[model samples]
Target chain A: MNKTIFLLMIFLSISAFMLVGCEFGKYPLILDSSVTSGAIRVDLNLPLPVQVTQTTSVNISELRNVTGESVDSMKFYNLTLLIDNNTSPNDAGITGTISVNDNALVTLTNVNISEFQTERSIFDKDLAGKGFQYHAGGVLFLLNALKTQSPDILNVTVVAGTNASSLHFDLKVKLYGQIFANTN
Target chain B: MTRKRSILFTIMSVVCLLTVLTLQVRAQNPLEDAIKQLTSENAKGYLQPFVTAFGANMNSGLYHSADISQLGFTLRLDLIAMGTVIGDAEKKYKATNPYDGSEVETATIFGEQGAIVEPIPGVQYQFQNGQVKTSFIPFFLPQLTIGDVFGTQAIIRYVPIPEVNNVPKVTLFGIGARHCVSQYIPAVPVDLSASIFYQSLEVGNLFEAKTFSLGAQVSKSFAILTVYGGLQYESMSMDVNYTYTGNIPGITVPDANVSLNLDGKNQFRGTAGVDISLALLHIFADINIGSATVISGGVGFGF
Candidate 1:
């Protein structure tokens, strides 16, 4: 009986060592709900909605696809996002980010962003309509369509107060059946 | 029809039909083939359709699976699983990594994004200190590519006219290479690659004099054209018997003493070409205005 107890103590000590090692394990970044995974190349942009106070219209075309590389087409669907307070009108700060899969920073600051998508479907091609607006103070929020299966997502933030408040959103792109051309 | 003629014709037709059927079956089996079908067919165009239509995703999927031979053995297995098949191993493979030394690596992506940036009130970005920097518009290019048969060709031979008549032997060789040309025009940089190739063409016997060749080729691309050139020096060495008149019955002369330079009499070649990327497909053409002139047109996929 004494020998069995001694063996149990030895096993417990080994388990404790493993648990401590795991505590210091290398998991610098953890994948959470806010992160997106799959990214594709698509030519789409979001023009800044009307600035509340500023006379100059905010340009939304700055947010680009991965690496800001020029994409002729892309498809994405099912996305979650967060935006800070910096996209407000009174503040000239970093642009609000549009999340694709996970990696963000899709746009730098102060640039005209426009979105255009030529979606491929089983039968015909449709154009995706996009828009953006200032949420409250300076935060800019946006959504666009990538393809029939893929939708564009944005993580919006307004850097207006003493500290920025992060906002979360889950977005899906819904396309209208008839083609809408810019008649002008 | 006469009985004799009909009988003979029936036998002959049966043989021809069998041969045609066999060839057709083999053509559908990709592993029974080299990349030549993929590469050479590319030269004739339609590579994009072949890829998109034939579940070329299988090729990419297999590549991302377990590691494969340079000849894509893993892909061949996947093709087999997909109901497409390969026949005859030895005749099919020109060169394959028999050892399967390389291991497969799995790629992972980010699961979620953690933090985000926001705007500030009454704060200026300083607008780069009111500096207006203007320069030329920058350009960009895509990465990741794989291909075989940078280039290749054949030869015929005859003995020095002793035991054999002009009915000499023929030698053949399969040539291939992996080419990577990284042109960063935005960075104004050019990375080129050059390699030496050895190939032989033979109809039957190795005893027949073998033509030895050492060839070098270099490839580069500008905005308009991609240029490549190489020299393959082929020569025949001889074992000569001399009549010194000494009459030594069993005395042999020498083994491979001198190499005959076949530069002018043998071959040299050069080429200039261009490839225009057309969204779904790409069109490429090359013209060789040199010793061994050949003009080839090719179409393939960029993805």
Candidate 2:
């Protein structure tokens, strides 16, 4: 009788304890964050026949607002640039270098202002390292700056190739991406 | 047995059971990542399915049959396994992309990854993927039932686990009673009973849940085979506490402490099952239909 009781206790204990704190499923999640450089404008005055260029800077200080801490990784997905020509003519040639955190990322080679005069104006269909004229080193520098720096900024400089004419336009850049996180 | 010795035996058995059960370790951050990714407002829809499924499972398998003894005392122990099915409707939800002010159809915590949407052409944003991608949510527990003081049975289920690794401690406690109604009737072909149960579950300080149910059951026995069915009215509610690490626009708070009180969707359920008795061993299986469908089974040893 003693042996039978002891064996019964052992069986019952093992059966009950095995079900406690037993994890049933694996859950993996991917989060997302949206980023944008608000409306920025470049203005220049023309008093001589020589061309003029001006730089406009915008502060990107709220990246951490969306990409919370303890995230596994984040990557840029689709990026686009929009321009509104306020004072410059449609036929004018615009050239400028875009920089992030004081590092030169891309230099536009006489991009025509007419391409942005349509009802829907968006540049760079392939911004995820495809068909975009961005230096690899510069792109990496920008991503690193956004990830590490608290107060990062993007600088846009526009130069008008047409002489004897003033230049003025508003520039905006939007970034969208995925953030990988695990719920373990 | 003397009353004092019986009470001492019960306490020793419960203590031994709890000590052995705490040896298992579980790793699950149930609400930590939800707050980080979905924030306060959106976390509700993302986690609603889990609350409903858990509530349905807790309300199921309360009893395999309603045949309490009318005379001498009997004791039984059961290990119940229950699962709640996840329907297609619980997979998706509509949420606003706060950055661009666009409505996007996104996945819930039990769904597939959401589709990437472009609020404005050339600018796209994606939603969070599902945390659990399964068709059913399962739960298991051990239950004890003792009976026959004037045709009534008492039921208890308790499991308390300490914090292990980084995961929090978990505790579940339930108490219930069943009364046989057929004992007062004459020439009844089926055994009839009514029961009421209340259960509470806590996961550290992050989550707390409470459920209550009142049910009526009927069963017919043929030698070693018994068939049972029941109808229950139940309700469940949960309170969640977490730190909101993600910021929302026009919201001045940072790292805000968020608390949400949510109610489960399952209100009424119908259950049907069969139980087979073999001397000292009993095995049973059942299915419940409610706001969600749940399947339950158990193995028990009884006298």
Candidate 3:
């Protein structure tokens, strides 16, 4: 009987502690990203054949939480556009633009392999001297517009200026922002 | 055991059983809840408040009575649980698409929209946005006290690096002293004492907390049962710095760190409880009333 009472007392004591210190909350800095990729094809026989364009759209609806709300504002600290022209023997120059709900937000012009190599070398120098080719920029205004517009859609179009049969490229964007919801 | 002792034991046993059953029923996805709260933008302002509440709860129920026998020893363990009552905040935001210079109106706290990564040509990876939500957490500590020098008892509590699943390495240490005032008045029927304690907790590099408390307590012993009451003044401070890295559907979180400092001053508290001792085994439970309600209980060996 003494042993049983001791054990019971121990159990109750632990339970009492667990019951009272039961609530807490945390606020953490968050970083999120979005990526898209596609190919652009050009035909010399076609009118305005100097340029070939490919467009794709991203749905931001899923970004909404239980409150049916999306971010009110955001800033894009890093934007990268990479083009691969190795598929074709001829070199192709590429330019790209990002739009939210059909409204243009960011435009990258004269994005080519040589320029990418040059920028990479400037940012990072190594004994190999080999560098990556990609277009990079910071667009806070564009992200703010996305938040203000609350557009459920984001569209991206990549235009390639080349005589090559096809040009393939990739686009990656990183955004940072706080989320606000209306409880009232 | 006497009739009163048996009845009190039965009541405590029933309460413990009910509490255990409630815990089983209340158990939910704590990880999901934690993530939701962390991702919410409005939760930023409430971080310090949450820490303050946590500190207050930690300071409560440290001691049941000021009575400490000269040359006596005791060992005890305590557990504390707390929850936040603050509501979530709401705000407006402006979004603009730079491509077309168009604007949109959206309502939600700020957080990462996540990223899509494709390593293979046909395979795609996407992550979801970060969200913050409120949750319940518990703290546990063990303490020891020894008395007899200069009418005072020296107290110590420690948890040498414990290995618990999902919890970081935790190290807790505390030092305190309890002085018996009744020692000077041997004819008094009531036991009187004054005590002060300081405790510090280090959970890896993610969290650190310190609390200092001073109180006076008195209890009258009747056979194996003792009823006690006390007034306490407590101060607490804490710091939290944690970073999260993971992959979720539709969103990729590369770096997410939550950091904050919390401090509280001169919180006065009142407490009352019952202590039941059978031979060397002791059981005590108490409730503290202050800025928050803190209920605590413990089992110990006293001689």
lDDT for B281 in candidate 1 is 36
Error of 3 at B293 (Å): 0.7
DockQ, cand. 3: 0.13
Candidates' chain A TM-scores: 0.18, 0.60, 0.47
lDDT score, candidate 3, position B19: 52
Q: How would you encode candidate 1's per-residue C-alpha lDDT over A115-175 as one tens digit per residue?
A: 2111121111111121222222211112233322132333222221111122122122111
Candidate 1, residue A21: CA error in Å?
Answer: 78
lDDT of 2 at B207: 75
lDDT, candidate 2, at B286: 96
Best by TM-score: 2
Give model 1's TM-score versus the native structure.
Answer: 0.20
How far off is residue B274 in model 1, in Å? 2.6
**Fnat (0 to 1) per candidate:** 0.00, 0.19, 0.17
Residue pairs of candidate 2 with colliding backbone atoms: none
What would the per-residue lDDT of candidate 1 be over residues B145-200, giving only the tens digit for each residue? 23322211111111111112323333223232323232212242433333333323
Q: Give the DockQ (2 decimals) of all models.
A: 0.00, 0.14, 0.13
Model 3 RMSD in angstroms = 12.4
Question: All candidates' lDDT scores?
Answer: 0.23, 0.67, 0.49
RMSD of each: 31.6, 8.3, 12.4
Minimum summed lDDT over a 10-residue window in model 2 chain B is located at B22-31
CAPRI-style quality class for the chain A–B interface of candidate 1: incorrect
lDDT of 3 by residue, B206-273 (tens): 55889999988889878888899888888887775555432122222345675556575328888899
